[model samples]
Target: MQNQKTIITVTGYKGGVGKSTTAVHLGTFFGSRFRTLLVDADPNRTAVSWSKRGSLPFQVADERQAFKLINEAELVIIDTPARPDSDDLKELAKGCDLLILPTKPDIVSLEPMLEMVKDLGDANYRTLLTVVPPYPSKEGETLQKELSEGGIPVFKTMVRRTVGFERAAMAGVSVRDVDNRFKSAWDDYVSLGNEILELLNK
Candidate 1:
């Protein structure tokens, strides 16, 4: 099969929505299968830091050099900065094969995500509900319904809130390394990865 380059951008309009986490894990997952390049566009450089500490097998570049990195790899994953309303985001989105908006299952997180979706201007994107509580409360269901009604594609699989995630973050490891208590979260990430690949194929 001919190698087709796929560029996936993870963005959020708010901070602490797990944008870097998703970018890193997805890059690692896809890298296991393909030649992947991860671009850390956030000024914070959280993804680059984590990759360095974790010794992840991926290339990292600043926002200015990310486009060149994207051109050189078969798969490019861009991790945008939190609350970014800049022209750089627009330029990155323009080249994306899929745009993933990772949001926590709460109003504070959902609101800005909606705004970012609006700013995206009808691009093909999906909402990934992260940091979801184990047994979703009524509010969680309500938020999910609202997003669906707003014409956003929300994934059925959710990433549950867990200390393991934090631990993995501190250790610069993916949730795949988390213990049995977070098996579901790991599976959800795997499912998300599959969904992403399917979307790219389409």
Candidate 2:
């Protein structure tokens, strides 16, 4: 089979929605099957720092020279900053296979995320719910229902609110890299990786 380059940008209009976590783990998971590169496009450089801390297997680089570096890997996952400008957003979205938008299942996060979808105009994108309560939350259920009813594509696998995610981040490792204490959260990310791959294969 011929080598194919796949670019996935993980972004959201608002901050604190688990964009970095998703990018880090997704890149790591993709690395298991393909040569993968994780780009820290956020001015914060969170992904670069996390890789340094976790000693991730995949290569992590600053957003500079993205196209040149993309030639080095089959999959490229970008961790973007919050509230990027229109021109920058368009440039980032250009030619990307998937624009993965992470959002919390609440009005506070949902409103801005929806606004971002509008701002980005038409593009290949999917909304992944993050920081969801483990218990049945009316807001979460309602938001999922609303998005589905509106014909918006949402991930069937949601990332739950877990202290393990924070702990794993502090240790500079993906949830799966952490000990069994973080197994549940790690499992969720693995499931997410499978779902994303399935979607991309379609």
Steric clashes per prediction: 0, 1
Candidate lDDT (C-alpha), each? 0.77, 0.83
- Pairs that collide in candidate 1 are none
Name the TM-score of candidate 1: 0.87
Highest lDDT against the true fold, candidate? 2
lDDT of 1 at 166: 79
lDDT per residue as tens, model 1, 76-141: 888877776746556657888888889998778877877777677767778888877767365556
Candidate 1 global CA lDDT score: 0.77
lDDT of 2 by residue, 60-85 (tens): 89978566777878888888888877
Q: What TM-score goes with each of the models?
A: 0.87, 0.92
Weakest ten-residue segment in model 2 by summed lDDT: 135-144
